[model samples]
Target: MTPTTAFKVLTGEQMAALEKDGSFAGAPVDLADGYIHLSTFEQLTETVDKHFAGHDDLHVVEVDLEALGDAVKWEESRGGQLFPHLYGPLTLDVVVAYGPLHRDGTGQVQRPITG
Candidate 1:
């Protein structure tokens, strides 16, 4: 499936730093992996369920892939799906919208509304 945009799941602290600094290098895991991990709208729920379950103060930032240029690559990841990976720092300018990550009664993360 072709995805026009992707979402970055970050901690509140990381979001704050990105907003404050105008750009973010990478999260620890991203640093270790050499690229920032991102999830498509379809992948968000699973990403949250697998990685950020029971976590609080998390933020889901909508990203414009075109704005990121060629630095964004779709690489094979979980379940053999190709996930978006950013080779460079993430600039706040590319963020379309962001909000707190919350769960619904079924325990799945509520997808953030984005423009």
Candidate 2:
């Protein structure tokens, strides 16, 4: 089966549970020092799917923040195959920098505090 994509970011508590449960198929995973970094989508999906089960109505999307231009552009542009049409349009709200940012934070090398 084709590997699924990441719909949204996850919490540290959720990440820890996935790792302990072996839901990632023993792939390399890490959630250290208040940051999460994975090598591939397969690893990411394995963790995300465990918690995301039973939400079949929701479509999982993996968005590239850089390619989509700024937040305003994302809000205005039409979504692709990843996003569900019911969402109409998408809006990206970037949070403030807090503490030390990690290399893979929010698809960029910046810490995000999305509320």
Candidate 3:
């Protein structure tokens, strides 16, 4: 079953831009790919380790997939896993929670706290 919520990893600069603009077109890779890449909670840690590693100023944005409706597509990616791809600008209104990416003592990525 596909999860209804997923995470978008962004740099501090990207997060700031999203805040300032109210909507984010996407990061460079997202622009090239023509969609914003998102990962389910299960995929978050590896996504961070693989793509976002070595970056300290990273943030995890929890988004409501249902809120995006048809704009979100589930497509095959890394290891044939189904990942969510947003076909439109990611508006801040759809964000349920967001914060700096943190890890637990066991080295697992911790989900952001909801404010």
Candidate No. with top TM-score: 3
Q: Is candidate 2 or candidate 3 better by lDDT?
A: 3
Query: What are the lDDT scores of the predictions, listed in order?
Result: 0.87, 0.29, 0.92
Q: How do the residues 49-84 of candidate 1 rate in per-residue lDDT, one tens digit apiece?
A: 898877888998888898988999999999999999
Clashes in each model (backbone N, CA, C under 3 Å)?
0, 0, 0
Which candidate achieves the best lDDT against the true structure? 3
Worst 10 residues of 2 by lDDT: 81-90
Q: Candidate 2 lDDT, tens digit per residue, 30-107?
A: 222121222123333443445445433322223333332332121121222222111112222211112222235343
Output the better candidate (2/3) by TM-score.
3
RMSD of 1: 1.7
| RMSD vs true structure, all candidates | 1.7, 15.9, 0.9
What overall lDDT, based on C-alpha atoms, would model 2 receive against the true structure? 0.29
Q: What TM-scores do the predictions have?
A: 0.90, 0.24, 0.96
Off by over 4 Å in 2: 1-40, 67-115
Question: 1 or 2: which has the higher lDDT?
Answer: 1
67-105 per-residue lDDT for model 3 (tens digits):
999999999999998899999999999999999999999
